[model samples]
Target: MRLLSMITLALAFSPFAISQDPTTQSKIADATQDVVPSETSTQPLDFWMQKKLDYSTAILRGLAFSDFDLIETNANQMRMLNKIEGFVRNRNPEYRGHVHAFERVTDEVIRQAKQENIDGVTLAYHQLTVSCVRCHQSLREAE
Candidate 1:
């Protein structure tokens, strides 16, 4: 607890930790602004799971930024991301490969988005999103 508090305090006081690079910040901000809202639902798992895929794709496309920001960010997005990651990490390879692909494509998409290659980013994001939906659809069918 003491070590954790000291580390947190140190991070808070560090200039390098406090301020993000302007260009990277701007790209992330712009990407975050682009996520479309998910449809409302009473089913918690389905709602969050579907939205997680959407958010993941948006981040990949550079249309949606990380949930670390204040503006246009989903309140529960980080939780959803963690949940998806946990699910993916524990699942069998056949079920988890899509998550790995998502991580790769989203990383590429974000890079493209920062480079201002909008079309390329969009294509990658679209492919990743489609994969997520397909995977979930398969799960649903299996059940």
Candidate 2:
């Protein structure tokens, strides 16, 4: 219930507004501290996990196909999601720590992808996967 409430509040005041006009874009930076990509800013978290999963899968495909564009794009998207998620959550120290850790890994992945370093990107992806698992465990423990 609390998670649902938080989602509602985030969307209500967030860049998730239907149109990404100057006002909506401004509000996004106010809380999430980043420019949420206008294309995806409107989707609520209720259905956003699917997009996250899709992006993750695309990252893997990019690795397999040696597509730097795909990998960098998706990695950047994940970073944005991480920022929005941090604000939409309870904002305790522990939660913020998890967000920061994920953001670090996401940045690493983006950097490696841009450099076309498959080995580096693979290592960073492993770290990102582990971060996801740890954060999920923490969330369960909190509940």
Candidate 3:
């Protein structure tokens, strides 16, 4: 009897039981479509590359608007990405040097962003972009 009552209560509160409205179902489907996939579902290299692009874009946006909070968030993300396996593992000395250079510049960017030093951040950002281009060029040549 208790189990039956519990089932009855659940059914009573369930959306499908309350209404089979097409609009409600459509709304739920649309909301689910906006959900981001789990990190595990994405290819590691692709995921990190996309993150770098996204964080870089966010940093630019933050700089334009003097949004230190946004800059800090993205810069921190970039720092974390530097330590990931995709970035750090199995790298040759030259590749590793490039990675280290990128990290050093990124650290400077983070520090400048935290200090709200726009000019320092701008310089560091340019250096960071150069590091990215060099690293990517080397990677392409290696392939």
Candidate 4:
């Protein structure tokens, strides 16, 4: 307990633990604003997951109403998210592979929508859902 307390006290006064210089702090804040939101520590890990749910739900809504525009829009969002995932670069190859699969499935979804092929869209969506589930499962197993 004494050693831990001494270490804690040492860290408390450490340069990284406390900002003694106001100018340095302001500079840090200014630099932070230029970073990608996803690269920021303020972003929650599940933030991307929430986006996935939203876009996927929107795609479902499109299917329910036979709205090709909605389907394409959501699929485009998914493709964008996939690109972001690439930029974020999950070092786990499994996650990386799933990201690629997501892009391919999303492309298929957009293509099906463009062709006005509801059946093809439905099939592609099933594949996309399966891909998402499998990716999540792999992550869980890794954990």
* Number of colliding residue pairs in model 2: 0
TM-scores of all models? 0.48, 0.68, 0.67, 0.70
Evaluate all candidate structures by whole-model CA lDDT and list the values in order: 0.48, 0.73, 0.69, 0.73
Show pairs that collide, candidate 3: none
Candidate 2: which pairs clash? Answer: none
- Over 4 Å off in model 2, which ranges? 1-46
Over 1-143, each residue of candidate 4 has an lDDT whose tens digit, in order, gives 35334433543465643653665444433433322235336767576677778889999999999999789767866665565555465758888888899889999999999998999999999999999999889988989
The RMSD of every model to the true structure, in order and in angstroms, is 8.8, 8.2, 14.8, 14.1
Model 4 / residue 141 / CA error / Å: 1.1
Over 21-96, each residue of candidate 2 has an lDDT whose tens digit, in order, gives 6763555446343323222357654444565677689899999999987887778667777776676664578889
Considering summed lDDT, which 10 consecutive residues are worst modelled in model 1?
67-76
Candidate topping TM-score: 4
Instruction: Tell me how candidate 1 scores on lDDT.
Output: 0.48
Candidate 1 residue lDDT tens string, 81-117: 4333444345555556666665565555555555656
**What is residue 30's positional error in candidate 4, in angstroms?**
25
- Candidate 3 lDDT over residue span 19-116, tens digit each: 73566445433432221112454444465578788889989998899898677667756765554433335478778888788889989998998899
